[model samples]
Target: MLATGHADLVSVFLGSGTLTVAGQSDVDRKATRFDPARTTVNVTDAALRPAPGSPAYDFLGVPAGTPIHVIPQTFQPGVLWAGWNTEAIPRGALAGDSVDITLNQARGPGLVEVYLTGLDGPERVWSSRNPGPRTLRTAVPTHAHANWAFTAPGVYELEFVASATAASGAPLVSAPVRYVIVVGPLAAAPTRTTLDVAETVGGLRLTGRVSGGPAHLDGGVPTGWMEFHRHYADRDDVVDHVAVDGGSAVLPVPDEPDALGYTARFVPAFHDLVAPSESPTVANPRAPPGAIVVGVRDRYTAGDTITATALVTPAQPDHTISWWTRKGSTTTPRGTTGVLTITATTDLDGAELGYDLIDTKGNAVASARAVPLRVSPAPPPTSTSPTTGPTVGPSTTTTSGPGAPPTTTTEPCVATEVTRTVRPGEVEVVTDGHFDYGPVIEGGTLTARVKDDRQGTPTWRDPSGYVFHLTDTARTTPPAGSGYDFLGSGPVWTIPLTQRPGIPWIGWNTQHPSVLGAVTGDVTMTLESVNGPGKLAVYGQDPFGGVGDRYFGTVEGFPRSTAIPAGRSGVHVHGVWAFTAPGSYSVTFAFTTTANGRPLTTKSTLAFHIGPGDPAAARPASTVVDQVGRTPSGQECALGTRGLADTGASGDVLFGLIVAATLLIPLGLLLTNVATLAAARRRR
Candidate 1:
């Protein structure tokens, strides 16, 4: 057994069985470990491509809404790869775990480069390059796309690439992809326009024009449907729509309110060639009111009061109406009320009265026609006379008519004559009094009265150089060398004179009491012309009332020569007759001249009174004569006075001689001294 084949056989059989089983199991394990399935490296296609006709992909004239697909044709297992990648990666890795995309224009010529920027923020994703490629990276997957823009409008070939890293730590990239991008040309926008508004008679005219558009285009003015608006304070109203003519339109203003205050606006028609526009607002104007009427009278009398009235319709509360009158150089305010009363004075005889209407602030609205005024003259007073007689007997007269009762009236006193007995060369004192002639009107008669006082001495010098002296006591003879004759005097004392507008004539004193109430003399006056170029005449009317006579005295009549030589002087005897009537008496003196065989005459008068000299006595009760003709009444009188007195040489002659002697003595002494001086010189 020890070296024998039994142990060997048993051991060998067991070992051999065990070895066979172990070998089979070992084979099976090795087969399971070495299986044929395993992971490999692969990638998706990525590049930049153009959408030819899509609207979204339309760059200028390119197709729109097309996808950009970049396929890497040159992509091999170990070469450069380019495309867009939309996968996430770990932080701070090659693509920062975000979409990684790039564009390259290195192989493209004469093409606009592509650029990409952040859509939401200002991040430069990719820059445009003419001969290079630009890249973009993100750390996380995002839906935000970059803003892709082109530098110019043209076709472009861009190289694109996308990159990522594998889970097994191997680098992966897309192939360099060529992208064909088609760009198109650009277009322009429409232009702007304007409108205007103006005023016209019927309505407001709207005008407008279009500018800055295509030169040859007919869209210069808005041509389609348009609207007009009238804007009020409360609301805006659409007036109407109308056709525009050469860039303008018109709309009538509505006749609703009397005063329409509104603004007008024009809405231009909308078209593709012009922009929308409206006009500036324009306003309306104001109008005026109505007219007035005035009323007045036509005729008036001096000192009469008249009224004028103004009538106005639709009266304004603050308006004022005034009446006025304009005479020669004066403007007088009649009244401020509508109705005015004016007192007509003599100055306003032909004045014009007018009226004016004014507003509250003194703006004149209207003026009335001026009316002319007519005024008549004033009237005169009544006249009557008194009776006078002697105390012994009643001076009465009886009148009997056919159908009247017997009537008796007292008459004036008569006079008797008595001569004064006087010794030769005896001077007698005679008392003569004064008379007054009252105020005189330019064209009226004169009246007189007896002045109870002494009269002032009068020195009368006629036009031809004749002088007379009459005093209170006596009348003086004409001076020794004077060209006058001595005229007589009588009991009648003073005579007052005045001038009135009538025929040119004079009245001389005619009648007187010869011997101081003893008797009466004839009422006459003697006129002597000493020297004159004219003929002098004495006119007298007797107290019994008749036509007077013109008397021309001769030189042989001594104190009564009427027709004197051309260069000489004369005098007239005035008082010698008794006055029988108690009324006004007039004596006239006339001077007549002849030139070229034509008679030219001038005259003056002396009017006197015999009784009470009242102004009413001069005014006639019946018909009287005036400048025009004989009128039925007399004018109102304005009376005045002039007086005559007697101035004589009673005591003045001696005093005058003494003055002459004194002056001559001194003159003689001066002459003697002069002669003595001449003699002394001769002797030397």
Candidate 2:
């Protein structure tokens, strides 16, 4: 008696009503016997597995000829499990026991329900409701399979429970299980990347390329982006992202010192397709040495101080340079790194000074050749002693020779002799004679005289304000009537004298035959009107002007007695004179002024000769005067008729000879007749 497809037997009974053996013994007595048995089947836990090489199992009490099926399933250790199902054998059941087993549980598809936690945002990688559970069963045997359809790449913790009921009406519930799923490649990062450091003006540039990634849609090029990071001593700087064009990227490194560390990474845009990678640590290299320039003076004098300096490009910190001389024999440590100072001595003349750049270990990194020093000798000292002498004074002398009458001669002025030395770039002014020589011109009785019988000191002022004094020996007395009375004047000033352009001297003669009275021309001189506003007056002492009287000439439109106003500074003024007689004339020029309330006065004398006179009286013009030609005394003069007849001894001799000749002619006739009578008598 099987119940319900022979899965379980409710009861089994056997009876023959008091057994046949007992009926033979006691037929009369009524006898009865009964026997009963019960059987049941149950389902046990179901296990999901791989096709082969999976965990194997043995069946106990499974009846022979029972239908058992082996099914294929997909299995992922942390994701899902699917395989064949089995029923539990009854306890104490023999291998041949009468029991039935059936695998009637619905064999649907296998699925994994995944919930992602601990993420920055919400992300759903897989869900069963969208496409329903995947079929875990397959017809093939001993084959590997996978269903990797992850929407995003990240870590996910999965909570899943599998539930099913066996054909025997038994229910089975699997404990809640957890699985950690890393959906994408293990670590999709940059790889085989390189960091090349290049130096720039103010910093460094780092460039690199990454190769590993999904082939780009356009070609086999890598499609992704890269990030660069520079690690400094104190901090890390992250550069901007750059697209991986042609599988390469470049970035500018932050301005920092050399030997700094940095990193580069290649990250794929499709996180699921390619794994990211990072490059090994790379460092920047040191920069090359910069240009060095040394500055030193070329020449100096002995006992002078010398200084030198060196300028280095791209000035580095803690860098030092040493100063040396003569192949490092003479070393002088500089107070500063690049500056040097030394006292120049005679021994150091024509020597070389050198320099070298050194590192912390005192090793020379760069060097410069030595520069030569030229030392000259110091100059000599100058003398400042004052000159002593009476430069100008009047002198009178009387001399008498044998057979000659004594005669007295007077000179208006005579100068003393003195010597001086002048140095370069310097001018010396020397004054002589009495300082109180007053009234340059005076008159007494028939003779006009100079006060104190001495001329004032002669001074010259150059354009550069250098003042010089004329030597007494430079003075000269002029011949009579040249209209120049002063001595120690003329071009002797040494002051730069230039003629005024376009202004000709009116009534003055610059042509040849410059004899004083021969051509009846005017004597002219130019005066530089630089010494500020002043008065210039010309006083003339002539024989025609009687005692205590004199003639005054006009200068620059101003009369001799009146002061001539000085023109603008640097202009030239002309002083002109016209004399009538051929004799020596004394002319005095007095210049007076006040500068800033300081009184000043300058007096000079000019002397000139008029005609060719007695050679004994021929005196050269004043050295200060610019004479155009010979004086009147030096010219040739013709004799007139009256002067020829007055030739004393020669005229008497000619007249006496003529009278003797006239008487001799008559006497010769008378004597000739007598001689003829004598001759006739001598012949008889």
Candidate 3:
């Protein structure tokens, strides 16, 4: 597996009542959150060859002037800085408004210590040299950096957990999360692998060879199986494993029409002594051109001006470029240009900017995917004027008849929420990208979100991105005993339980990394509402056409919910989603789960263009706005003063710490998690 050669900065934040860890390097413009079990954080030899001799630094338990690896509390030019923050935990959300961080275990070659330099002196938070569990308590909305000291160069695994009492009188605790830190020089020798693919009469043949280090003490060739991964539109799937024979492996796979690309990785038998290697992606004949690139800003505020541009590989100057806006099967042509410039208004929020490459005949040959826009509200105005006089507030009084209780009307708080819309061509056409609901830590709140998983990478997309076009291929009559009487004995458009050509394969997978790692209970996705030309129903069926789990339906007296088993890594489910008539269907769904002892629920509206009707005319289930935050509660009620500049979570210190996929998803991406794939190839 790949080790984080140099994480210039690492931030551990409170996510969904759990510790969310992320790291950034000089080479990485944005910090990325990774699964500690699957990643290794590397502390290079540049840390500290000679430890600080100051008496104040002696608490590190290492001899002064001796060799030590130190991730400093303050930023150093070439070394990494590890820190913690509680900014994602809102004020008054926890009992006593504080969170407890505990270092449950620290295993390393030598002593391991973490401390902070306070105004009084050095305050030690963790010391493996000492005995009991070391814990630190900090108020919510806190962010601080600390010094990490290691006595010897080796691999260290630090286990951490966060705990608190929720304001609702429940105990909240995080799962034990592990962080692997490798203090270099590394012990293992690296290796490399190369792959080649050829077409045979039977199918496609793959050959791979491993070389580099004679990683064994006996100078023996590496012996292990080679794992082959199939690349789809957005993710990679393991297809086959071939054991190495004479340092090389060959595997033959049946020719599949939809196959896009292939990649291979070498798994060393002496895994600990020799690092595994991976081969670059080998594109198939059907693989789309990778040279179509798009560029745009990450985010914008309302009323701000922005520009989005696209670049073609061969410089298609003669090709006509047309800009378009898409929302639920509706496409609005803007103009013909390679670049689009416009004012970012609130209405444009959640919308997308895209370009179509049209041939001389006016037919679109290639299209750049729609990139979603994130537009936040402008900062509230500053109040610094001196008041001429103290303003008096008006007193309210309630009056009612003597026999009746006071009759009063209380105005319910109305918070605006947003769930963006997406039409055809907005997202690349894909056969599979497991869809599910997972927790997302954003804006200081842990909220459930509809996520799209491409391989092991999970991304939170707006409801609009969940749209699917139900074409004639999905048209079929409901089978008897299918428990789908809601379709009224008429032909319906259905996304099948099995994969079919020219249509999307929609499914829910609770095994997504985020959901499987953080959640401890069953997840329920319920249909809250639906708006369309006709009714809708969702249910699972066996290959024999026997119906199984009935999830949701718009017909009266039909089930409207389905539950996924808790913490099960195999809960990948696909079902038939049937629609009664042709038109755009806006289906509202809510995913609920109890995580960290707190009950959480997130809602979103998915758009479905059923048949040949004008899908653009279909209205959304509910309106979406940007004057509101994307938190689970979507609460906008607030009255507060602007605080001084500090390293809060919202600042660059922690803001980039939240894990998210890039807004611009390249079409026909042929890539894999080479590091993860290598580790996964190890023999059992």
Q: Which predicted model would earn the best TM-score?
A: 3
Model 1 worst lDDT window (10 residues): 4-13
Better of 1 and 2 by TM-score: 2
Please give the clash total of every predicted structure, in order.
Answer: 59, 31, 1
Question: What is the per-residue lDDT of model 2 for residues 306-370, given as tens digits with 9 covering 90 to 100?
Answer: 77655443454566777766623666443445667788777677677766777788887766546
Candidate 1 has an lDDT of 0.28
TM-score of 3: 0.32
Q: Root-mean-square deviation of each candidate, in angstroms? A: 68.8, 66.9, 32.1
Every model's TM-score: 0.15, 0.20, 0.32
1 or 3, greater by TM-score: 3
Error of 3 at 390 (Å): 42
TM-score of 1: 0.15
Score candidate 2 by lDDT. 0.29
The local lDDT score (0 to 100) that residue 190 gets in candidate 2 is: 35
Model-by-model lDDT, in order?
0.28, 0.29, 0.54
The residue-by-residue lDDT of candidate 3 on 429-490, one tens digit each, is: 23332344433433323444444433322233444444456667567776554455667778
